[model samples]
Target: MSGWQRVLRGMLDILYPPPPLCALCERPLRHFLQGRGAVEEPSLLCVACEKQFAFIAGEICHVCGRPWIGESCGDCLRRKERDFLFSRSAVRYNDKMKELLARYKYRGDRKLAEVMAFFLQQAWRLHYAEMKVDCLTYIPLHEARLFERTFNQAEEMACLLGKRVGVPVYGMLERRKATEKQSKKDRAGRLHALENVFSYAPCGKYDLPERPVIVLVDDVYTTGTTVAEAGRAIRTGISGAQIYGLTVAR
Candidate 1:
């Protein structure tokens, strides 16, 4: 940010502050950190709330990468025979997590996206670090939705992660069809609705690197239809590309 822009934002922050302190913590961080120490890093959660929600654990499906109660979610154990069946998300879409995602995505809180990306990076390091990924791409927003929202939250998260992980972020997947919200639909309904909705194209004019892999990013993964369709496009439209997905919500 430029100097003037920073000054303006700072002024606005004081005038109309973003929710003071962490959303979960009712206590103000100014009070928490008072005389405790000088800070060298950026953090709002006085270490305890930060550490409590630090990581998402327990058994997760190898294919869909969702936290499961039993051995595996039905989608993971049975992916209906596809080239790219594996998928993963950083956190589950519980009530609290959903509120955070809404704040970042709809309320234009980019900093919240950055904090959420921290969890995403942790999930990647724990589960997907061994995968030789070539690039990161976000599940693209439709042109209409892109205009309506004025930003793509998934792409925002991807750019943050790409900066830290030392990988290129590409907007390769295109949304050819617009559909209703998946959150309100059943799994079969979602899978059928998006069958002809997405397509994959070349990342750019340059020839993609050899044995290049692609990681798809999205805000949420409920029914797995969106990413599955996008992955199929990558497998068919492009060659020699391994596809994966990273989502904030599962």
Candidate 2:
């Protein structure tokens, strides 16, 4: 943030202070209430709530980003083809993460988008900081689903991440048709159902980068079927593009 932005933020804080209670646990933040230390950005989570995150670290699969002893996980090893170059996730899809995502995606708790985007930013820094990311795009929701949900969680996180990372966010693909929820299906079922569901449909206003390195953003990475199909659609539009998947959880 710039100096003037900081000044403006401070002014805003004085007029409208952040909530004293943690967003999840609703415990009062002693530090904020006491006003003892220099405040950073208004925190949505308490230290305890933050500790619940199971961040992905240490050795991981080169292809899938799953915690593994070997370079590649068995699933990736057995896969005949993958559209995207590779994929990385910020955290494990544990019980806490599941609940958090449910609140955001299902309950329409938009405030949690910041928390999800923060993890995506961290994942980018940890894994793709050195890479040349031309732009960021997201797995698009179908029109019907988008209307029903009011907003796309993946798109929200991608936009927030784009602002923080100085990368442009684009709508490079769209769902051709809506299918049944992937959660109900097994890996093979998901793969078969998602086939040819995504289609490249870049926005007319923005110019496409030549042979770009595109990062596909999403809330979760399960069987890798979703992003793989989306990447394939992107390839159909931009043949030379190198695609990578980044999700909040795997």
Candidate 3:
């Protein structure tokens, strides 16, 4: 954050002392009290506001976790459905969530990530028992992107997750090819452009552990293109392990 922004936020923190403030509403909390040290858990969102970001439910697609009004989303209904076991994000990518995410991703708001990490940790606890992850890896930014941003948002999320879950995060995979942003492409274009873009390098600083199970971590899960392509490379080059995926958004 810039010097002025930090000063203002610091002032706010002192005056407000964080929560009981709603994570979604940004209001002082008088009830529903849980916090990340000072930053509150997203649970501070009042029940009425919480309903706007309903959890995924019913007849959802088996792969991408798209909310199904009837049977499945169009992409998941296609024959070439994604192969990863299903997925769930913490909350809907609503205006509030997107603004908070952009603050961390675009505006260098590290403090916001701490609050988000706790929220993500809650979601992980909610669903991970059924998922049973064996190993954990994160999608990496291309070297150029990493240098420009000075941090990969996925890596930041993974850092917090590693601390929360006590699972080691492998920097085993490398982004070998710099490509156009996935958000710029149609689904077919995104999938095609990602082919061979990610490479796995064994014999890193940490030795590969046994059983070979892993959860691929990333900050966003938009269309599932990045994780699917990254997982394919890992299966092809690394150990033949089942891959699970976790992210802050879908």
lDDT of each: 0.73, 0.87, 0.70
Q: Which candidate ranks first by TM-score, i.e. highest?
A: 2
C-alpha TM-score for every candidate? 0.77, 0.85, 0.76
Off by over 4 Å in 1: 1-44, 51-54, 69-71
lDDT of 2 by residue, 1-250 (tens): 9999999999998998965877678897655322112323454567788679888888899998989998899889988898999999988999999999999998999988888987787678778877889999999899999999999999999999999889999989989989998899888888899999999999865666788899999999998888889999999999988999999999
Q: Which ten residues in a row have the lowest lDDT in candidate 3?
A: 33-42
Q: Total clashing residue pairs per candidate? A: 0, 0, 5
lDDT of 3 by residue, 1-250 (tens): 9999999999999987875666556776566735323334446466555556545434455566656666567776663745366565666677766777888888887766665665567557756745556557788889998887789888778878888778777776888888886678887798788877888875366555553667788777787777777877777765566767777776
* Deviating ranges (above 4 Å) for candidate 2: 1-23, 26-44
What local lDDT does model 1 show for residue 203? 63
Which of the predicted structures, 2 or 3, would earn the higher lDDT when compared with the native?
Answer: 2
For model 1, what is the alpha-carbon lDDT of residue 23?
A: 40
Q: For model 3, what is the alpha-carbon lDDT of residue 46?
A: 60
lDDT, candidate 2, residue 153?
A: 95
Worst 10 residues of 1 by lDDT: 31-40
